[model samples]
Target chain A: MEAILKVEDINVYYGSIHAIKGVSFEVNEGEIVTLIGANGAGKSTTLNTISGLLHSKTGSVTFMGENLGKIPCHKIVSKGLALVPEGRRVFLQMTVQENLEMGAFTQGGKTLDDDLERVYEQFPRLKERMKQVAGTLSGGEQQMLAMGRALMSHPKLLMLDEPSMGLAPILVEQIFDIIQELHKAGTTILLVEQNAQAALSVADRGYVLETGKVVTTGTGHELLESPAIKKAYLGG
Target chain B: MEFLSYLISGVSLGSVYAIIALGYTMVYGIAKMLNFAHGDIIMVGGYISFCAMSYLGLPGWLATLLAMAVCTVLGIVIEGLAYKPLRSAPSLAVLITAIGVSYFLQNSALLIWKAAPKVYQPVVSGSLTLFGGQLSVPYASVLTMAACLVIMAALTLFISKSKMGKAMRACSEDKGAAQLMGINVNATISTTFAIGSALAAVAGVLLCTSYPTLQPTTGSMPGIKAFTAAVFGGIGSIPGAFLGGLLLGVIEAMAKAYISTNLANSIVFAVLIVVLLVKPAGLLGKYVPEKV
Candidate 1:
């Protein structure tokens, strides 16, 4: 499989504290790669660094054969990399449709309209609540909206951070099912999750990160059966 | 008839305050800081147009356009020089810099244009009597009110419909998320300041024409009053600024006519204190819930 996105030996610091230290990872063109870690393990930080919200001090992020060094966040988005941020940070003041429209901000009118239709088709709940303010939506709905908004940009790579962070178990299952559906429909994903059990189930490749360093790398099935991972993460 | 005239004057004054308040609300919305220099920009704009009209003998509308152009460029330069570098600094620091810039502007104008008042040509002159010749409204007042409405309506539509408007809204909501959505947050903020300053230029020109005098401190009282209107209406909300300005104008005018003229300022301020005590978020402001 061809690597679509690559992060090699990247280090990120927030003030004096090192957040992501010498981390390296890659996502193949048609794969769901999950990054599993404990609390304060820098899972979200890694995603943020990739999306250009936070700059990395060292190393390179080559996306689709282009080096994304020192590029501003907006310019990075224009290159077809989208991050569905942690906590589902939808524009609370805007309507669901407006939030989706903003996803297509860099695109032309014709592309934007087409992408809006595509987003509505995938998340019909968003369609029903199109005119409703996003902040008023439930947590699960906002997460869907976040994903739908990112999809509006037609990203070649979608990175999701803690998509199931605050939700009922049933909602978590539904979200994972959507992830599976998207993966089957040929979208590359980089998922960061504290929910190890569900994340491993859908991911093709998995990396266990501890304290900002990649500790183990394997196929999803191998990581799921590993005793150490099972004990620390799955509570088996 | 006497009461009707006061109301007419109030509406006209309110319109000026409303346009000025829009600048304050918008700058606060995107930049998250008070552009204290904003009010002074109005004075500078007024002076610029006055010069163009008096010395160069430019037409009325052309002078207004030139003022707007100068103010827009000046706003960009001010933001780039004074505000941009200190963006991540403490809010108090940025605020003090703004005050410093405000004083710098006033002093510069005093030095250059002198403290003496200059006669201003009314953009629209003459008065028309109404309601059996008891109530009369000046054409300048009518023009001021019409310009204010047109601008307010156009801005509201721009924000609600335009892509850049959505980008501005997004930046105000979450800077990081906005950037992640392919929005140049800094650019959005700069555009917000430019628009706000452009409106200030319009407000300045119309305000001077209404009063028919240009002084170094012409914008001081009206600027402060407009700021009060922004706070009264809910600082970041667009319609709040409009409503607050109009209401403040009416309230101030009514107080002057009905109550003691010396006590009008006191009465207007007292109303603000009462409103703030009851609703700390202002009339239309959203109550920001603490996330943590």
Candidate 2:
């Protein structure tokens, strides 16, 4: 499989604090890759750097062989990479459908009927509440809306951070189910999650991150069986 | 009969304020900043109208159109140079910069146009009889009301039906996410300022004709009043601002006629305070739930 996104020795800093230190990873086309980490472990920073929200001090980020350095977030999005940022940051004042419509803002006036129908098919709950304001939705619903909004962009690469955060156990299952559905639909996913066991269940490959660096990388089944992963992340 | 004439005057006056309030509300709704220079934009519009009419010898209608055009361009320039640089700065910094811009523009006008007030000639400065009551509405006043109504209608349509309007609203709700959706955040902000400043120009032109006198600092009181109107109506709601302005104008007029004229401002502000205390979000402010 060809690499759709390649991050090589990327260094990102926030003022004096270095967040991502020479992080290197490759997300191949049509694969689900999970990055698991503890808090302040530089998971979000790596995603931010790739999405053009934060500039890297060193190293190169290539999406489909095009360099992503110094590109604005909007322009980066136009190239078919969408980030469903942490905390389900749906536009609260807009309706659920409007939030989805906004996902297509980069598409200009292109046909969105298929994208809209696909999103509705993925999250039926969102379709029922399409007219409701996003801020009024439950935490899990908002998460679904956030994912639904990103999918509306018809992105080639969907990078999600903590989509199950604060979600009910049932809703978390639903979110993960949607992630699997997205992968099956041929969208490449780069997922970041603290729920290592659940993420590893669906992820084809897994990278365990500790303190701003990749500590281990292997096949999902291998990491799931590893004693270190079991002791630190998956409780016996 | 006197009361009826006052009603007409109040409605016309309120409409102008409402137009100005729309600019404030639109920008505040999206940027969550007051754009303090909004009032000065109105002053700039008036000066532009004066120059077009008196200096360039353009007719009244042509001058008004020219004023709107010039002020629109000026608005885009201000956003590009002033507000754009401070986009990521703290809200206070932006607020102070806006105030500074307002003062700078006003002082520049004073220096160039002189401190003396200029009155744009009234296109209709006559009396009309309606329902056995004689009322006088300056042609400028009628024109102002007509212009405001048309603009308000157009803006309402744009916001409700246009793609750019939806983008603006979405950006207002969540700028970061809007950018992720491929919306040009900078361009949206600039467009918001441009539309707002253009509305201010219309108000400026109308006001000069109605009052027949203008000064460099003419926009301050109106600016404050329109800001108050924006707050009184929900800050983010276009229709709310218009309603609030009309309500404020009528209340002020009634207080002046029936109550004490000196107490009009106090009464209006007191009403605003009472409304805010009851509902901090204003009349049309919707409740948004925070993350649990």
On lDDT, the leading prediction is 1
Give Cα-based local distance difference scores for all models. 0.91, 0.87
- DockQ, each predicted model: 0.89, 0.78
Report the C-alpha lDDT of model 1 over B1-292, residue by residue, as the tens digit. 8888889889999999999999999999988999888899899989999999999999888899999999999888899899999989999999999999889888999999999999987667889888778788998889988998999999999999998888899999999999889999888888998999999999999999888888888888888999999999999989999999999999999999999899999999999999999999889998889554
The prediction achieving the highest TM-score against the true structure is 1
How many collisions per candidate? 0, 1
For each candidate, give the interface RMSD after superposing the true interface residues on Cα.
Answer: 0.6, 1.1
**DockQ-derived CAPRI band for the predicted complex in model 1:** high
Instruction: Kindly list the per-residue Cα lDDT of model 1 for residues A31-150, writing each as its tens digit.
Output: 999999999888999999889888899999999999887888899887989999999899999999999999888887687777888888888999999999998999999999999999
Cα lDDT for residue B60, candidate 1? 82
Candidate 2 lDDT, tens digit per residue, A162-220?
98898888888988998998899899999999999889999999999988899999988
